[model samples]
Target: MLEIRPSCERCDKDLDPLSDGAMICTYECTWCRDCAEVLGSCPNCGGEMVQRPIPSAARLAQDPPSTVRVFNPDLMAPTSD
Candidate 1:
């Protein structure tokens, strides 16, 4: 199951569950479209942003789970040589 996060890691902007602005990497690190654009790409792995899957209201009604996930952006920072 995709853990749809609630907010962007960089700016902490709210990410709508159905928003096309939500972007993710292979690691499932989530970001908003603006952050992804300004950052030039996924800072963690250079992955491109794509539309996230939104759960239908029917599906959500069956079992509601928190959309928010804990992600530390600092951990994604590149190490200095």
Candidate 2:
């Protein structure tokens, strides 16, 4: 089952389970569409970003979305070699 993470990993924006603005990578790293557009790809993994599917209300009721927030601001921070 897709984890349906609650917020964007990059910007910490709240992404409701029913929100169409939620974007995710193959690894299930979630992000908002705006951040995904600006980054052009997943920062955690060099994978394509695609709109996440909104689960049906019934499904949501059966299997609730994750409440955990994953914020890693330094995931994209500049690294000195």
Candidate 3:
């Protein structure tokens, strides 16, 4: 199951499980669209960036969003591959 992670790993921006702004990699590394595009991949693992599924409100409440957040505020997306 996807943790639907709590925030962007690059920007530390909130990415609610149901937020349309959410993007992720195959490993479920979450980020906001802006960060995801800037990174061009998951910085931690280098997986392709893609849109993440948004859970329904009821489902979200049942599963609850993850409290743990992952980010390196000092890290910036690489400019080149």
lDDT of 3 by residue, 9-78 (tens): 8879887677889998888888899887677777778889889988888888788888899888766634
lDDT of each candidate versus the true structure: 0.73, 0.90, 0.82
Q: What is the C-alpha RMSD of each candidate to the true structure, in Å?
A: 3.8, 2.7, 1.7
How does candidate 1 fare on TM-score? Answer: 0.69
Model 2 per-residue lDDT tens digits across residues 1-81: 789999999879999999999999999999999888888878778999999999999999999999999998875565444
When 2 and 3 are scored with TM-score, the better candidate is 2
Ranking 1 against 2 by lDDT, winner? 2
For the record, the alpha-carbon RMSD of candidate 1 to the native fold, in angstroms, is 3.8
Cα-lDDT of candidate 3: 0.82
| Deviation from native of the Cα of residue 71 in model 3, angstroms | 0.8
Query: How many pairs collide in each candidate, listed in order?
Result: 0, 0, 0
Locate the minimum summed-lDDT window of 10 residues in model 2. Answer: 72-81
Q: Per-residue alpha-carbon lDDT of model 1 for 1-81, expressed as tens digits?
A: 677788888777888777788888877778888777666666677786676777887776775635676566684455444
Deviation (Å) of 38 in candidate 2: 0.7
Candidate 1 Cα errors over 4 Å, as ranges: 63-81
Clashing residue pairs for model 3: none
Cα deviation in Å at residue 11, candidate 1?
0.3
